[model samples]
Structures are given as C-alpha cells and as structure tokens.
Target: MTSPSTATLHPIGRSTPGTEWWRTAVIYQIYPRSFADSNGDGLGDLPGITAHLDDLAALGVDALWLSPFYPSPQKDAGYDVADYCDVDPLFGTLADFDVLQAEAHARGIRVIVDLVPNHSSDRHAWFQRALAAEPGSAERARYLFRDGKGDGGQLPPNNWESVFGGPAWTRTTNADGTLGQWYLHLFDTSQPDFDWANPEVQEEFRRILRFWLDRGVDGFRVDVAHGLVKTDGLPDHLPAVDGDSMGGDSDDVPYWGQDGVHEIYRDWNRVLAEYAGDRALCAEAWLPTVDRTALWVRPDEMHQAFNFPYLQTEWDAAHLREVISESLRAFPAVGAPATWVLSNHDVVRHTSRLALTAENPQGHGIGPDSPGQPIPEVGLARARAATAVMLSLPGSAYLFQGEELGLPEVIDLPGDARQDPTWFRTDGERYGRDGCRVPIPWQADAPAYGFSPSGATWLPQPAEWATLARDVQEADEDSTLWLYRTLLATRRAYALGSGDLEWLEGFGTDVLALRNGPVTVIANTGDAPVALPAALESATLLIASTPFAGTAVPADTTVWLLAG
Candidate 1:
C-alpha cells in the first residue's frame, strides 16, 4: 500500500522500424478550443497547440488526437466542417498545422486529426450549391436530400429525430424561393448529412484523406464512424443512443452502424496501406456492445475503436469487471487492441461522473444549477483508481486533456454562456457538453487560468481551478499530475500495452485483480479496505493512488504490484 513519488523509468523500443506504433500506444485527446490560446482572442488556436507541444511530449503520451479544427461556422464546435483539406482561420493556416505536426513528430509523438466525413457545414460550397439547384439535380445528389411525405410535402420524410433534438430533416429553398427538398442533418441544422451511396461523395473523402496524409499526419479519428451510410429507403425508426452520440448502437437504427460503412473503411484501409509509417485509422463508432463494435475494427478496417461500453459502466466493481472483460475479449478477436477511455469532449468528465448519486442523475451529463449534490472529493479518488486500473491493462489508453490534474465538470456554467448545439436544441433541458469542455487550468494566478493572454475564454473556467492548476500540481509530489507521469513511465518500463490479461480469481467481483506481465493490478471499489491475496503479500509495490502504509488496500483505491 506504500505509494512512491516516482518509478524506475526505462527506454521504450516503440519507435523501432517496422513497428506499428499505435498497437500499444497511449494517446491523448485535445479539444482544440479548450487546450490553449496563443492570441488574446477568446478562443484557442493551432499556434496555441504548437506552443504546448512540449507539455504534451513530456506527459509521456505516444500520440495526440486533435478534435476538428477545420473551417466551420462553429455551429457544433468544429464538428460541422466546411472544408476537409485545410485548417480553419479560427485555428490557423495550413502552415501552422504543418509546423505543429512537424514539432510533434520531432518529439517522437504522432498526430491524429479528426475526420468528420458524415456531414459538412451548411455553408460548404456543395451544400450551398444544392440549395440553388433543383431537387433531382446533380448538385443535390451528394447529400441526403429526399422528397417529403404527405400532401405538399408538409411532413418530414420519416419519424427520425435529430440527435441534438427536433426532426433530423430541414427543408431547403429552391431556385424559385419555394421549399424544394428536405435534407437530413443527424446532429445539427448547420450540419447536413452526406449521401454515402454516392460514389462522388466517397471519392471526395478519399482525396481528403490523402491530402492530410501527404502533410505527414499519422492517422485519423473518424468522427461518427458508424453514421456515414444510412439504411436504404430512409426507413423510419427510433434510436437508443447515449446523451453524447448520434450513432445508435442498435441494429434497427437506420443511420448508424450500417453494413455499407465497412466498404468505406475497407477503401480507407487500402489508402492507408499506400502510405508509409503505418498510418492508422481509429473509429468513434458507438455500437451496442464491444463484441458488435469489433466488426468495425477488423484487420481491413480501423486499427482501433473507442470502448464506449467501458466508459459508460456504472462505478461498481462487478459492472466494471464485466465490461472490462467484454472489451478485453472483443477487440483482440479482430487483431485490434481494445482502446480504453473514460471521458471525451462529448461527455461529462469522469471525475464528476464517477460521483453520481440518486439525487445527482448526471451519469451522462451534469449541471450544478440543477437540483443535485455531487461529491467532488469522492469522485476524484475513484477517477484516479480507474486510471490506474485502465493503464495497467493490456491495451491502449486515451486520456482526456485535464484529467491528470483531477479537474471536475464545470456544472455551474451559466445558460447564456453555453454554446453546444445539444443545449440550444434541447432548450437547456439537457446541460450539454459545456461543463466538461471549459478551458483547462494552466497557471494558478494568471487570468483565465492562463488559457488566453487577454483573460478572455470562450467558456469561463471555475475559480476553484486555481488549486488544481498545472503549476500547482507540478510542484507537489502527491499531486495527480505526478501520479500520471510516474504511471506512464512505469507502463512503458514494462511494455504492458501489447500483452495478455489474466484475471485473478478468488478475490470475488468487489475487487478486480489482473496480471499483465510483471504487473498485477488490484483495484478495490468496495466500502471497506481489502487485504491483498495471500500469494501476493510479498509482491513489490510499484505505486498507488492514495498513500497508505498497510498491506490492506483502502476502499476506492488501486495499487500496482510487481510479481516476483
């Protein structure tokens, strides 16, 4: 139970020639708007990210995934992309992105850009031209423009609802100024879904992929990976997805996880194979189960898919054990490693989520203004324990930007300051993702936590973050930031990323004990302290989330032990 400030570090052989760097890599997700801001202008930009490359490189992650920085109207942040091949002026020019990519590569870190192919901004040239042409014209053929039902086409084509809220279809004006056709926008009105059945649409994305690949990007995180190809005939049905997803996990859903999406990835895989450096593609597919999700990451498809099931599991030992076991069993069957993630830009942060109570019904999203009481201190402990257990596993782990500093969801963001489409579309019924995406605290005393030089931020940060700033944690050995650095160093020392997981029985479901090579991770999620198994009483202690001096592990804590 003794916690150490640091672990013995070793040189990793991850960069050797002929090696697939992503197989066992640790990747960090950066929400571009929240990470940093170079200009005093209220938003973060690409130059801001380039200025912080040293910070990420020292964090020990093998790769960094940049959320959409493409040109857009910021309708749904940057997900509503207008141009796919170039960086948006709000972020930076193409030269800034190239400089960032080069800087990252120089530090032995790979870069993964977000690819939002499911839809494009309404301002996109294709979509604008579609509005200017007739319903059946070639200009309108690339998107999901369909004729409405009922007399005079008053009703929508189907009963499908937008994942944000309201109907998924929005009527477009024809050349004569009459409502001509209905176009589908699964997320937001500003984002119109594309007709994947069209060969022209598919070819355009292929060229876009090569465009970024030619610029030295290592891979892509395919946004809405399962929603590209809709069901034929635009069949009508309800969908069962979580608060943060448009891609439904159910098979009956018309616009998600369709079979035709495979052909797109198969073609993409071939295109990736054409490039050197083993360029990879990871999916953001939200399938029903990891077993079903495995279908999207077959050898000829994506290299990795986010384990959403594991992310949503309740903070119970048995539930976590079950989902982790499912993820472990499912991904390897396809020669792809299971990717573990706790939080992302689209969902509530794990630190706040793990503290959900019956009163705090924000297992998905949180709002401090709403009637609920969330325990922040208790949640931080569990989040740290979960990170320890996840990194100790035998697959890649993705870390959200500010989790290391134990940042909580900004549940009290004012209604007027919120910008997520879900918030506006739902009329504030759901708080949306503004809470988890506040600008990350960097300097303890600087204005706007040093996010922007002018003390201006797109989303306001909490005053309490002063204590959790990076500079504060950098000085304290017991801080979460130090724990992350040491754990990452330890993970590389053992090469635990690409290995097998063997569960240790006899401990029951209240405690999860698994052996990965020289490390044995034992996590106790119960209300009472638990003694380590008798055989491991003599095992060497590597590190722990909470500082303790006893052989029995504290409740809601995880310890990594080195096997003899």
Candidate 2:
C-alpha cells in the first residue's frame, strides 16, 4: 500500500533519489554574523558565506540552513525582521544571496533560509502604517493591538511576560498626547506580534513564501513555528508547578502551539507543492511532548521538526536511552523524520553544556554568574561521544557552525561588549546567547583569526582559540573537524540516515547498544568500561569517538561497528 506522500514525487519535500532528501540529510546551521566576515565592516555578509561554501561542501552536509539575514534594526539579532523581501545591508544584498544560493546548488548542496513570520520588527512598514492609522482601520488590524485594561487604560491588557523578560505588552501612543492601545510582543518590544486571524496577514506570508521559493531556495527553517497564532482573545498564561511558562508542556499558554498553527502550515504546504522540487518546511515547534511535537510534521504540514527531547536529555545513559526510545516511536508514528540538534544560535554550545551537571532553569539564559562549573576537557570528550551517537541514528542531524571545531561557550565575554537583548531586558541578570555566537576561527594567528581581511569582528574572539582554529585542526586527524568529516562520510555511504533502530538486549543499562541496519552503535556512559559481546567484537570497527581498538568500549565513548 503506497501512502500519498510516497505515491507522489515528494511530500512538498526534499527528493534527492527516491527518499525525501531531508529525511536523512545532514544540515549545517550558519549564523551569518558569527560565520565569516568578507568585507572590512566588522560583520559577516552573504559573500563571506559564499566564499566558505567549499568548506561546508567538504564537510559532507546535504544542505546549509542560514539564520535570518533580512533587513532589520537587529533588535533581536536579526530575529526581529523589518523586511522579508530583501536582505539587510549588514549581511548583504539580495543579489549576494542569489549568488550564494546558485553556488551552493552548484555544489549539490541545498539552501534553507530562516523564515520569521511570527512577528515583525517595530520599524517594519506595515507596523509603522498601523501606528499612524486609526485603531479600527485595516492597517491597525494587521497587528495585535488591544485597548488597555482599567478605567484610565493604564494597565496592560494581559499579564504575560516576554520571552526575553518583562511585560509582553507595550503601550502605544496615538496622534493625541494620550496613551492608547497596548500591542503584544512575545519576544523583544521591537518585535511586534502579528494578528494571524487577519486574512491579509495570511496572504502576506504566503506571498513571502513564494518570493523565496521563486528565488530557487530549497526550503525554509521556520522561526517560532508554533507561534503563528494566539488563542482567541489572547488569555493570560499560567505557569505549571515546575514554573515552565513555555516549552514541551504549558499548552495552556495561549501564545504558543495553538491549533491555528496547523492550518497555516497546511496552506504553506500547498504553496510548496506548487513548486517543482521537494521544497520543504522544517518546524521549530516546542510542544509539551514528543507526541505533541509530531502533530506539526504530519504529511500535509512540515516535513521535519527539531528533536529537542534528545537534545534536552541529560548526559545520563539511562535518561538518554528512554528519550531516544520515545522519540523513535513518536516521530515514526507521524511518518515524519525527527531532527537532532545539539547546539544552535540560541543555546549554549554543547562543548560546555555536555560537561555541566546542572541544567539551567527554563527561559533563564546562562551568563557569567550561572551555576554549573564547566570542565572543558570532560566537555570535549562527552561532546564527541554524544555527537557520534546522534549522527549514527536514523534521522536528519543539524550541526551548528563551529561545533566541528569543538568550540566551547565563551562564558567569560565582557559584559560591556554583550549585545543580546535578553541581557539588557533582564538588567544583566541573564547572560543570554552572545557567547556562543562569536566569529569562527579560521587561522591560528591570522588577523582577526582570518575572519576578515580588516582584522575586526563584531564580537570579540577568545585569545585561546588559536589551537581550535580550522587551519590547525585541518592538519590533525584526531581533530573534531576530522572526526566530523569521517562521521558524515560513513553515514552517507551506509545510508544510515534512513536506517531502522533496534536495541540489542543483554547489555547493562549504562551500556547502550543499538543497531541501525547493519551498523551497530555502542555507547558506554558508565564510569567503567563495558566489554562488547562476542558478536560485536568480531564486527568491523567503522569509527569511534575516542581512540580505541579493543573489545571494550571506554567510558563516555561511542563507537560505530559495521557488521559483516
């Protein structure tokens, strides 16, 4: 029996051979400002990425997912989009983006750009018009605006906090000298939430999707995918017992994962289907559970969603095993591929995160005074092991730029130099994400570490990153970069991206032995080494995260074994 998805050429998706290309593809995330700086403007532009496409192609990723490069005031580090149809001069022109896409396609790699339809920068043309127009006019109707509560309208309409911090609603002033309505901003004040109930808003987004699709983009990595619509009459969000106001629970939170989001993607899917290729949409929906997350990726909606369950699981073997089991069951039930991501522009680098015993409180960004003392050496070991096991699994994997070089979070960044809006919004209580977004180190001693010819970078680089520079790692086979290249090559060659998962019995609870097709992946997370059974010892050793050539798997290590 052929399902409708397989019956067709592709499911509004990514078709390379017969399978949807994104199902098993390795996608690399490039944070434009932190990637490379081509011009001498102390910032990274599209041409900087264009110049480094070869490096990504050599790394064996099937595609590259770019962070937002759209024109903006950059209030939220480009997440606050001022214009969807053009590129920001700080990044590059649309012409430069076209060149990069053409070059990437030429190298057989797909390009997926960040699509931020959840909200627009306050400086956006529509929002500016909405401000000038009367409250009941069509222009004002495009934004989420409501009169304040209380007799004098001095109080906010609702008691919702911003994702960054503080009140979610900001009051607006009219042509008169009096304060008027309050507008919702789930994130920063500069990013005003859109009125999704408006048909004009929906049509505008559909047009934006076609604008990028017509430009020959392979797909879109939707930002805040679950936040397309708020519940009718935007209610106050009451926190759970554990104090999770957002994330894989908190369904009662009126601003996220509403039923209305499904309809938006379904319509987007139809628009994608109208294209020639397997143009795809990957959702970043953070729902209450893996089961809930699966809803966003159903055949008629998005093709993939980030597997936060796997990334959120601690370093403990028992906990990880359980999460992996649940994810394998949940995603398959929906006929959608699960995406594995260890780090991204928003989170702390796993090189530091993997070493910490304590998890940061939800919505609390870790900064200079955060808990958990990070042991970099231990972190590097665990990061390598964790990535090896993640890549060997049967799904899409996203590699954050600089993960290949084993980059640790720049925890000691100077407070005076910090730029993340969370830092200011929280009055420096939260360190925010500026640390993990520093520029890539290309040379051990080149000016600005070869990030640009000007020897200038938007964010300062660590002086000690000389050893982790790509040039230094390129020559060392034991380098994390080399290991990544090897891992990617093996995964592609064995077609492990679309493999099946089956756990091998008899191994201790701390010893994870899972078979993905003919490839056996074993990870020993206990403090003691675990000996492989006779069957696996004789099996060929495809690769190991650590140095090993024995029948026993070392502690905190992962190995991929090829069966005869």
Cα RMSD of all models vs. native, in order, equals: 4.6, 4.7
The digit string of per-residue lDDT tens for model 1 on 266-332 reads 9999998877777879999887788888999899999889888888776788888888898888888
For model 2, the superposed segments whose C-alpha errors exceed 4 Å read 1-18, 240-246
lDDT string for model 2 (294-374, tens) is 899988999899877677677777888887888888888878887888888887788888887666644455566778868
TM accuracy, model 1 = 0.95
lDDT of 1 at 165: 75
Error of 2 at 186 (Å): 0.3
- Per-model TM against the reference: 0.95, 0.95
How many steric overlaps are in each model, in order? 0, 5
